[model samples]
Target: MEKNDLISDLLVKDDELAVDYYAFAHPAGFLDKTSVQEVATALRTFIDTKVVGNQPRRNVILVSHSLGGLVCRRAILDYLELGRSAGARIIGLLAMGAPHLGTDIARIASKFLPSHSVPDMQPWDELLQNLNRAWLQRVVNDGDPDLGLEQRGSVKCQVVFGLKDRVVPTASATAGAYLGELKAINKGHIELPKAESLHDVTYDVVKQFIRQCIEGTRTAPVRRAANVLADRARHLVLQDADSALEWTRYEEDVVTLGPLPAPEWLRCEVNSTRTGGLPSADFTICLALDGHFPDGVRIDYRFHFGRGLLTEPEYAAFGERLKNSELAPQDLDRVFGLKHLYLGVGEAPELRIHYEPHDRKYGAGFALLTYRIQPERLLGVGRTNTLHVCLWSIISRNHGWYSYRATRLVLEKLTLQLIAPFPALELGSSIWWCEPERNEDKIDNDRYSSRLEIEGPIPPGILVQWILDTESAGLSR
Candidate 1:
């Protein structure tokens, strides 16, 4: 939080585009010693809270030079872990003479740089090696062999290195950068980030990259991705909900399209396998969500619980687990055999969220989970998005309730599914929906599901209820 000295020295003069810029700096050995990981952690926090806060439509492009590029990479890897998005809305990385590979100058010119930072940039430096290894696996290769670096849909990376630079080697600065994508300049390492004017080659390079980033956000794969997701959302139903959400594995898009927004008619499947705590259920309740974002998201999917049925100790225990670095987000947890399925991953690769356990505040046990629809150019054109949500509850056979809050978004279709064995479900309510245009069927031979293709916006505060008479209400095997 010290004066971000970088911005103090930076002069952004883009007349054609409306863009926002943010920069930060940390204390190094000059004033106070620091490490790249520390800087990266700070940068990650800044990104989540300031740069990308709550704005789904926003996009970010990281522009860094020299050692700062390593800071950016380390910070990125901090957030873009097993199950997180690009730390924030970061759509691209623009590195000017960054050292993904360690620099030869570390030993050759050690006294010229800070004691703490220069050593960390030495060839075969542990931090640089670790950073490069993960970057190669997660950012560069990332299993999508068909897509190019920029087209991967996670973060479009563009690299620029100085041919006349003497500080950081071209090989180090351009490490992990695609060979064909490298932009060579006659500037030095110091000159690459400092443009004399809009006429400077440095300015031209930066300008071109920014323009392409802006244009890319508005066209091509983005527009195509939106169209694809919108068209396929109806088919992207949450059909299979195990302890974790699962789906048939296969490559789909010609472009990875990464994580964009949820599409229209967002198909949601809520399955109640049992009314007990099990590997797939809460101790005494469970409702599983099998849904899709259509294209894909890195991690942006999120939902919360409000002290649901958790005693003070249990609530504290859960919060503790959340803080327990090893059990951080995307690290799955199992309680009574139930798998943590939010932001679902793995072979199934479906967006299956088994929502909250029980909350009486909603007048029903099921919480009304409101999920943000990131309008990340993947939800097609001509559509406005807002809070999207659904809920499922198993209460006394005498009554069950669900609620919806009207928002800027329209309800295209809502699908509700119930999973149970023959005996218990046979005694459950058969015709529950009041909506005339409803369809029902059996799934996996043991589950029952219903669908409603709504025509217009849903009324605000619409509370749905069902009452059924059962001989015995216990869940059947």
Candidate 2:
């Protein structure tokens, strides 16, 4: 908004990779009186003069901060609609602290300033909704020619936000509802595009995103993995082949009570196969804990189901099962139809079955059982739970891979948190997604060590692999 030379200050010279930067200047009054379309028109004029046909057919990366990001998006959409070649050249959009989704802060400002753009930034504003809907449709279609963008070319969209931003909250800045791979930095809204040095985390992430955009490798690995899983799940449920099932259980505990002592152990293994025209993967998890609680503890088994995974019919059946009084039997075996589990047309999408020992004798506090789930169901595609695991330890491992599929669905969001006894770790951990080149480095900490959040429409079923090393803390096996 001020006379800051953001582009010149941020885009330092790179010896290995040559890049040309351009900054668009507009009248200050435009911010208060002009509409988004008008601002976009001004931006389009600048691009036409400076970028279009000015260089060798190179792709262009639009890096915008704050309100400028919104203007850029509008201009891009306008170009796509007009069938302009400039639209095809847009490789990626790295929006920093831009309220792709309207921010409530604008609601307060609108009462004072009679600015047209300010109203457009209000939560659920009509203009914001229209833009978001169009953008989402384009993304869902993967930039299909039918959507106005070239079929062969794709635009990578990434949003970076400030965790402590007061003007724009994380949700608005990231635009989580419409965009995926939302990244958060430790800077404020004003400092987002003004990193002091290359060592700044925000600067590093922005640099990587720009490089990925230029190289045409903007899709995140997490999204690729999600797509694979979704496709497998669809095939398993839609085809006539019999479903394959695999079970795994890993646990570790410490019970230093009175007399009885239990051994501690850790085991991990993986087995894969193709059965009845469908692929099957299996994992083995083994953990042992030796400890006791004076007040007796309740091992809460919580299962989380991704949104939109259940069809209306399946949801109705699950509701009925919960209402059935006879189904309240405490016997886990009978409850799950003798196998301690069941999957069919009508069943709970997510199950939370608690296990409490009758007496504290301290001999394998929890049973060493193999919990099997069909690959399709475990990696849920449609209306089913795709992932299943026991929540017991401070450290856990999620290891598996899925084959690529054309019709793979998107994984909307993933959030993970660690319980006590485990100190909070910065977003940096041994988490790897999709390929070795891609790592989980864009992590944000809101003063909590046990919390990790990821925003995605990431492809399902790539490799969601990670290992938690607890050996240093004396947690073995």
Residue 301 in model 2: shift from native, Å? 62
Candidate 1 lDDT over residue span 1-477, tens digit each:
222222213334455767877777666433335777877788877877888788753577788887778888787666556234344656578888887777886766566655677667788889888887777655663314333333233556778999999887877877747511688889777777775555667767776777787777643333333322333332333212231231111101010001113211111223221111112222222211111221221111212223333345864555555444223222122211233332222232334443543321111222121222223322332222121223222122111112111111223433333232211121111123444354555554433443333333332222221211122223210
Q: How many clashes (backbone atoms < 3 Å, residues ≥3 apart in a chain or on different chains) does model 1 have?
A: 10
Candidate 2 local lDDT, 376-456, one digit each (tens): 543433333232333222111111121111112234433433332222222232224532232233133211123334444
- Cα shift from native, residue 358, model 2 (Å): 91
What is the lDDT, from 0 to 100, of the residue 7 in candidate 1?
A: 29
* Native-to-model Cα distance after best TM-score fit, residue 380 in candidate 2, in Å: 60
The Cα local distance difference test for each model comes to 0.45, 0.45
lDDT of 1: 0.45
- Show model 1 residue runs off by greater than 4 Å: 1-11, 27-32, 54-57, 85-87, 108-114, 141-153, 219-288, 291-477
Residue 423 displacement (Å), model 2: 50
lDDT of residue 169 for candidate 2:
76
